[model samples]
Target: MKFILASASERRIELLSRVIKDFKVIPSDFDEQTIKFNGSVPEYVMKLSKAKAEAVSSATYAFSESDVTVIGCDTIVSIDNLILGKPKDKQDAFRMIKMLSGKVHSVYTGITIINVNFDIIKCDYACTKVKFSNLSNQDIEKYLCLEEYEDKAGAYGIQGYAGVFVEAIEGCFYNVVGLPLNKLNKMFGEMGINL
Candidate 1:
């Protein structure tokens, strides 16, 4: 199968590389804010993932080979229903980090797989709880200097320097990183793509 990943996330790329060795990266251009869901966070994530997969799948329909599977993923960090997307700037990043300090938040990663030619589709999500340490202004400033918060949902990368700020985590650790490796692998297996 010709596998296509519908994201440019470095973390997602790295996590997927563990199971699938060769694949094409075609970032999805779907605007997420356009989507409004009245359901739970999991439902919202699934909708976004499906939209991303469908967007890329439809756009490249005529160009795909006989066996092609496109994967789309989206991650969100939330505290009591307040969703935290990627930070806008330095101040935004700082604000997000400070809010997450000393509290546990939920990280949700939605994954969608679709075979345009065969009409096969799947959508699911994984949630992990992450607790951040009580950070001082100096601590936040020091971590912000690393500048790894721009593309992360929670203004922090668990695999980067922010790892030290994580007090505890429940559920899949990879979910906090971006993509849930276990969930992704399981989806691939269910689709009959052994790897």
Candidate 2:
């Protein structure tokens, strides 16, 4: 069987490399804007992950003769039930970072695995509570200059300079980085796929 990752995230790719040595990266073409948030962050991420996995799986299924497993993932930060996705611009990024300063928020990552040949599909999510230290406007401005917030949810990347912003985390640390390795390994084990 072959393994494929339906995402182009460098963090996720690096994380997954710790478990699986060989896999292909096939970024999904699914447009996340098409999905609306319906008050459930976990479900929302799961839906997006599933759509991404299905998009890649369907696009490649016909071409491969062997079985292929496609893994898709999505991450988001939520505070007060409000979802914070990638910032549209610098000001938006600053606004998101400011809101998270000195506050506790939840980081959610949804994972989906699909084996088209076996007709198997699995979806799950992981959430981590993160507390940020108080940040002055100067600190926020300085961090924004690094441009690390551009493509990251909540206008921050826990694995980047934003790591200093996190005072505490209540759940899986890897989840905050994007992919929950423990949950992912367990999911693969449950599906009888040895990584």
Candidate 3:
């Protein structure tokens, strides 16, 4: 069986490579904005994950009838019932960082693995509560200056310079980074796919 990752995120590919040795990265052509956020954070992520998986599984350029498993994932940061997606611009990034400075936020990542032939789909999610240290204006300014917030949810990368801002994490560190590797391994094993 072939494994395909339906995401264009370099961070996701890097994280998956740490455990799985064989897989192809075929980013889905799905439009993320088409999915609406009208429910709980988990539900929102799950819906997007399924949408992304289906988009890749049905892609015209994708492998066909070859016993393939397509994996899709989405992550969001929720704070005070607000969902913070990728920043729109530098000003948006600054606002996100300012709001998250010394507060606790939840990071939720939804994962969907689809087997096209059997129509078997597995969906799950991981959540991590992260608390940031009190950040000064300089801290936010310095992080924004690095220009790494353009594509990251919540405008910060736990694995990058933003690590300094994270004072504590209550769940999977990898979840906060983007993908929850340990939980993903367990779920993959259940589907007879060894990492």
Candidate 4:
């Protein structure tokens, strides 16, 4: 079966490739910010993920690709009641880092798997509790200078230099990276698609 990933994230592509050798990366053009869940973090992500999957499915249908599965995912970091998306700019990056510094946050990733010929198969989301070590102003500044926060949720990359800031991770490490391997595999099993 052909597999298509509906995301622009190189990180998600790399991780998914580990399980399936042959898959296409067709980034969905859906505007995520337009989605309005207006509630909890998991609900918001799930709604966004569904929208993305629908977008890609429509696109794929236009192209008429049968016997294919499309997967769309979205990730977010939340602390307290605030949802932290990618930093708007450098100063914004600094501010997000400051909020996360010396505190624990939740990372939520929602994956939606769909096949044009069948019903949608999904593993809603995986939330990993991550604790950051107290960071000095210099640490935050230097991290911002590295520019790793440009396209990462919460203004930091758990797999990059920001790894230094992570004091603990309470769930799937891959979930924190943007995709949850265990949950994805289980979803595939439910769909009768095995790697």
In terms of TM-score, the best-performing candidate is 2
Question: Which one is best on lDDT?
Answer: 2
lDDT of each: 0.90, 0.95, 0.89, 0.89
Better of 1 and 2 by TM-score: 2
Writing each residue's lDDT as its tens digit, candidate 4 over 69-175 gives 98989999999979999999999999999999999999999989988667665748889999999999999999888999999999987999999999999999999
Runs with alpha carbons beyond 4 Å of true place in candidate 3: 60-62
Worst 10 residues of 3 by lDDT: 59-68
Counted clashes in each candidate structure: 0, 0, 0, 0
TM per candidate comes to 0.96, 0.98, 0.95, 0.97
Q: Which stretches of candidate 1 lie over 4 Å from their true place?
A: 37-39
Clashing pairs in 2: none
Where does candidate 4 stray beyond 4 Å?
none
In candidate 1, position 24 carries an lDDT of 88
Estimate the lDDT of model 4. 0.89
